[model samples]
Target: MTQAAYEHNGRSVERAAFYAIACDPRRSIAVEACAGAGKTWMLVSRILRALLEGSLAKDGHGVQAHEILAITFTKKAAGEMRQRLNEWLVEFAQAPPEKLAAELLARGVPPAQIAAQAPALQNLYPQLLASARPVQIRTFHSWFAALLRTAPLAVLQDLGLPANYSLLEDDTEAITAVWARFYATVVDSPSARADFEALVAVHGRFQAHKALGAALNKRVEFVLADAQGVVDASVPPFDAQFPAFAGLAAPEDLLWAQRPLLQEAAGNLGRASAVTFSAAGSALEQALTAHDADAVLAALLTQKGTARKFGEKIVGIATVRAAQELALQVAQAQLQHAAWAHQQRMARLTRVLIAELASLKYERGWVDMNDVERAASVMLSDPVLSGWVQERLDAKVKHLLIDEFQDTSPLQWQALHAWLSGYAGAAGAPSVFIVGDPKQS
Candidate 1:
């Protein structure tokens, strides 16, 4: 924006402070974006501001370019952030390498050296000509999952997972399913059932999955209490596989495992219980009985208004965002099968219930399917997973953004509050943005 435009369309002092910090070589702020606050515009402006102010400069030391990290919570959002930021910077800089070089020189970045580096940033931004460096951003969990796939040791150590277990070779699912089965058995007892059911009632099932993921990730790598429990396994050699360093594992992690939400769950119990069995049964039955079963199918396949609304609210949230994806899945799917004209909706809902029964057989999935559910179960069983995820998150970000704050799973909130409150001291600490519509929650 021009000086005049900036003056006329002045952002709030806090937002301007965000711009300044994002632009400046130092300083980072956590911004709570109220509704309609133009978060996208701000993100774009910050990227442009950083580029214009020489934040993209790669000095001889080679540290500055890689120093800054911007993390969002979802794949779609991350991509949008990168594209918008890149496009804004490219257009603002005249959509050409020469323009960037000239600006870099004007900023006293050493004309000769900047001429070379400017081409890189220009190409790297993706809005311009192609080059090499990734001058953009990533989701937090994605980056970590990549770390796990590549240098499993470093990633594990960083997250404090097992130092010795093979992240890839070990089947964390096998471990988790055993625990979940045991949990079910134990819960069958009157006292155990109350506490177990109570756990679900108090927290959501998703939190349990997260806890399960954490536990298995640790047992495989860090602590195998019984040598008897050790199951020898083999995965392709690290060299034979794609390098995880390049951010390859991230998209897959999100697409399949809902890793970000699971990662956040660490020790939270909200995932398993927020929508209790009572709620699910009632919602499912009411939904199925309310509509013609055949009509429900027609509505879904035909993209009718009712189905669309349900999908937008629930599916859109889960698939696009980390905070509400699972909840969205449950809510939307329930809605989808609710509007039955005949027995169709009831049949579908019945299938949904049956689907969970055999889900135990698989221990991994692309979309937190039955398999990933098992992995999540292991995470809840293990305490170390939470610590490990906590460690990884603590190590990287300087800021955190939470959504649906009022309904935040207790375990997830505890970790977040603790970390934001200074679990890592001031160094590399993340500023926090907590945003939620409490009434909606």
Candidate 2:
């Protein structure tokens, strides 16, 4: 992990890059790693360099193990990092000199230097382990929870909640109960009852449960902004909605009329139809004799015979053109109505759901994981409290390492950024290292 250990006879571009970042103690580093690129190895190498040589050196003057903060997205990652550091330290310390030399030599260290440095490196065994033990490596949520636990008074005061509030680990049961109660309450009200029934009649199901879950899980709080302009719900006239189909085609201009394919079929009433065995010829014989647009359209749209390639062509070119135009018009009208209905329903339910959840939270004096993050973010928004928290964190942490930076949401970033800014601005600012894949996130 020492800077000198990385000076070797041969090095891959990846290894050189790792050493470059890990060896440099003056500047911050941000890495955008692709999948299976050994992100964990790179991160651990950086941590080790900081511990054995850079900031958290074995010398009494280096930063303490507890001072370096490594934040990742999952508890499993945190455990892996801690385990890796511990194992590497133990392996290098106790292993035979030949074994240690093999490890160092494999890393491109000169053969002569590997044996020479092995003994000195062995001395760092106890120090590295002791230093790593107190190092703060945790998932972002776990870190935030720790922060809140450390200074609950300020966060509680800002949230307008008592200090004794508990975090409801599994909020599904509570949310379900609240949903049931809210539905029952709404159903008893005359206007609400009417709207609820109408929603079910129109959509055939209640979507509020799924909708609320989706909304709550988002990183940013949604503001249900009013529609930018007035919604014109009145159905547009057929001509306005579908200009091509709006103009009625005369019976003679119809595809069947011009082509007279049905007339041909009618001439040979018992001829083999397109499907060979189906009675399409007889059906066409009946429709062609009628010579009505309605009958032609009905036969074109609904008759199974019209589905065949030959049958479709026999429907007449003009008739097919007319049918396509009318079909598009119908489909567009239905789609527009469906979209509008969904938006209106979602808008109405979002407001109701937000209000209900707020009431529930207030009455219960409990919050979920999302609430914890949100509350911490809100508390950090105030300049005074943010400054206080910043000063508190600045006094302890010397380096900040973040993993899965892409998945870090805006709210989480806001809180972390505030502290990062404070740390960056301070004298002898700490190194801020971030690793992530934007594509994966």
- lDDT (Cα atoms) of all candidates against the true structure: 0.40, 0.59
Give per-model TM-scores: 0.36, 0.62
lDDT, candidate 2, at 291: 53
For residue 90, give model 1's deviation from the true position in Å: 3.6
lDDT of 1 by residue, 1-441 (tens): 533212212453442334444333233433344456565555444444344334344573322322335555567877887777656555644556667765444333444566565655555445333423444365544543433433324433433334433233234445445564645554555754454444445456676445444544433232222234332212222222333313423222222234344333221322234344223323333333463333323322224323222223232234223333333343343343222211232222222222332344222322222222223323323455534554554434433444334545433344345435544444555434444445554
Candidate 2: stretches off by over 4 Å: 1-14, 22-25, 54-61, 95-124, 128-133, 150-162, 188-195, 206-208, 223-345, 390-395, 422-428
**Cα RMSD for predicted model 1:** 23.1
Maximum-lDDT candidate: 2
Error of 1 at 127 (Å): 11
CA displacement after TM-score superposition, residue 315 of candidate 1 (Å): 70
Predicted structure 1: lDDT: 0.40
Per-candidate Cα RMSD to the true structure, in Å, reads 23.1, 9.3
